[model samples]
Target: MQLKSSEETASKAELIWAITGILVVFFAAMLSMNIVITALPVIVSELGGTQIQYAWVLTGLLLANASSTLVWGKLADMYSKKVLFQAANIIFFTSSLAAGLAPNMEFLIGARVVQGIGMGGLISLAMAIMGSIVSPRERGKYAGYIGAVLAASTAAGPLIGGVTVDTLGWRWCFWVGIPLCLAALVVVHTKLKVPRYGTPGKIDVFGVILLVTGCSALLIWLSFAGTPEFFEWISLPSALLIGGALAVIAVFVIVERRIANPIVRLGMLRDRTTILAAISSAAIAPALFSCLLFLAQYFQIGRGFTPTEAGLMLLPVVGGNMLGALITGRLITRYGKWKIYIVTGAIVMSTAMFGLGFVLGADTPIWLIIGALIVVGLGFGAQMQNLMLVVQNTVPVTRVGQASSLIAFCRILGGAAGTAILGSVMAVAVGTSAVAPTNGTNPVYAEATGTLFLIAACITSVAVFTNIAIKEVPLRTTV
Candidate 1:
């Protein structure tokens, strides 16, 4: 996404500072989502929450984030990216304040919902701004840095959350994020500049409602039906949820097709780059997100490691991501091509998935598990941001927000669907929604987990084939 040469080109030093400022906001947004994961137990106990209430604390954030993703993206096209970015920081900081001061579980959960609202905008708008400033040829280097931040923050979240809970108390898990958000706000205000497009006529209220409803309903169904203690997958409630989600989505499509200014640019899917990116995102994202949960489980439930120790064990995967992203970014910039890396990355990821499926297990040594994960991380770091660069490059600047956020939304939706599929298969295989590691035993659990990874591998292999269909468009040198 770029303007004509008539538009002023940003200076090299300016772009560097701009990217640096955005990275802090990006890191804060990513960290906020995961920082509460390991602190939940303490928060629940102190607040005397029920099991369902405890689950809601996390689910609230997820639902809000999913529902708000597209809306925020659309807003970016309508308003200044800098303003939206700063506003998102305010919202996140405010929610953190509320959550830290929350006297009960319900208040804390509600605050998280607000936090998610902020996060949705922060993530989407930051990328949209990045697209506006950098050309496709150079975006990979920045994207790689962004990917590294994302990977590191994700890996560090539990470790930070656990330490916060143990030393400063559960509330500080929320309070600790304030300084980071504040710094992002200051940097963005001082450094970032983005021109707004034509003022959008009357906001697309109807479309926003439809999209939020559809996404929320879909996420709700995934959260509950996928849990064995909740509604069974085939139960009446689950059927209604699935049906409602589809109906809402159908209505949303109709609205988008007819609206003057739609929240989602439905036409983008017609583009080959977008279609390929969407497919790859849908196919491969589950392997990343599901493993976050599974790896934690494998370490804690299977190996009986403490939370901090488990998080530490996952560091190699994060390290591999940083290494892979930096190398890929430099090579892409030097060669002025991305498809080669996309294809290679897909093959690498598929291989890693297959190895995790067939070669690694509970009895498998820790070194072997880490080794397989490092390969997966490398493959993921290479493909994730590079694919987005493809889609963003193809779309015009005005539609960049929609294009980038659509890819993000696709990954989220894919992860939810993949998790459901994995959970259902495991439930049917082992008669449990959750796997329990017992005395280093339970070959059935290992086999079920392996089977899930195998399914992921088969799905991801589709990307290698999909990449072949993409024609190489020359990378843009100017934004």
Candidate 2:
């Protein structure tokens, strides 16, 4: 008995460390997603790329990441997760190094496509791995750790990206995280262990192709839609391409429902909690992401702040997010009430969105901007991972991969759609503005960007009620 107890403690300790270490790298990997945004305009200007091309740089990564998420999740269910996780980090590290050495924006964008593949694996697999280790009752503690890492990464991304851009040049931003990735690899290799589980299903190759092709088309259209006159949504070629993509997507959904082992597992969508979480997550994407894009631009373009200064201005959002994560974790642990946080977060987020929309203008007060961002941060921190937890806790351990991936997919889709639609609106709004001696006033861009925020606020207001309608289930006691 004594010997058995000793081994059990040792195993648990190793598992905890492994989970913690892998998550750190996961955080670092995700940091790159947004880190490049603050520096992208400068990178594009230096590389002489057009704005539409610049947006593609972002879209390529988003679509690849979004589509691959389901693939990784399905693989985790079929193979050794530790092996897959390590493989992903290796890919991420190699891609970052390649990105750092890229000759131009085109090369950098290609490197990011590789980077996105690895990133998609990290987020989805990490959640699935956690489902294997911790019981639902105790998962919140570890989830808190994950939450902290996420908030920290998001908060620190722009700051780190800005500093790297200013001092070592933007390439170093890619190079800097390589060592951290290696560190995570070592920790997982040595410390992580789980009982082997036999694969039960075959890969759905057809379903994978269909999902990828459909999402890829949407992202391609979004990337080019507003940057050039020829890329307009109603334009003949654009309409044909987008129409074709939708038809493909509709076919893919049909395929998913028929597959014995579907890549996405549409059966989960029947769950009230899962469906609501996924939809709300998708809807909230436009508001949060578009804000991030425009605010970063506002700080840099409108306010004339350096990348570093813009990063600093974002601290309130980051700080508030951390607080919200902590409180929400405890609330779930103690009360088992998940929807309240979602409702509250949406309401708070909507209020902040409205504040930022109409209140912001040239020469607006920085303090007020920071205050509004704090609300946005609180809503995000409180709401983001909790939704994942809600879905994760509700499903069986075997289904964690699909469920987690689905929620993540919603968030990714939301972000891509938000950036695309809101970006077009902003561009048009900017075009209608007065020409200036310094920076020509783009009135239409400002108006459209502002309108997007109002739309985001409205969405969140609706989310508040949708959240309220969700019924809470008891947290799972075991995986």
Q: lDDT for model 2, on a 0 to 1 scale?
A: 0.74
User: What TM-scores do the predictions have?
Assistant: 0.88, 0.92
- Worst 10-residue lDDT window, candidate 1: 433-442
Tens digits of per-residue lDDT, candidate 2, 1-479, equal 11112134346678768777778788878787768766665676667665455555666676677888898888887788888888888888899899888888789889988988898888888988877777665666667678778778877877887777788887887877788898999898888875434376798889889888888777667655654554676787788779989999999999999978889888888989889888888767665455666666666666667777777777787777777877888777777667778789888987898887887776567888889989988887778878888888877776777888898888877777666666555555555221112123333343454676776676666667667777878886656
Q: Give candidate 2 regions above 4 Å deviation.
A: 1-11, 196-200, 226-228, 432-449
lDDT of 1 by residue, 261-300 (tens): 8878889989888898888887777666655555554555
Cα-based lDDT at residue 203, candidate 1: 69
Clashing pairs in 1: none
The list of candidate 1 runs beyond 4 A from truth reads: 1-7, 37-60, 100-109, 226-228, 359-361, 419-452
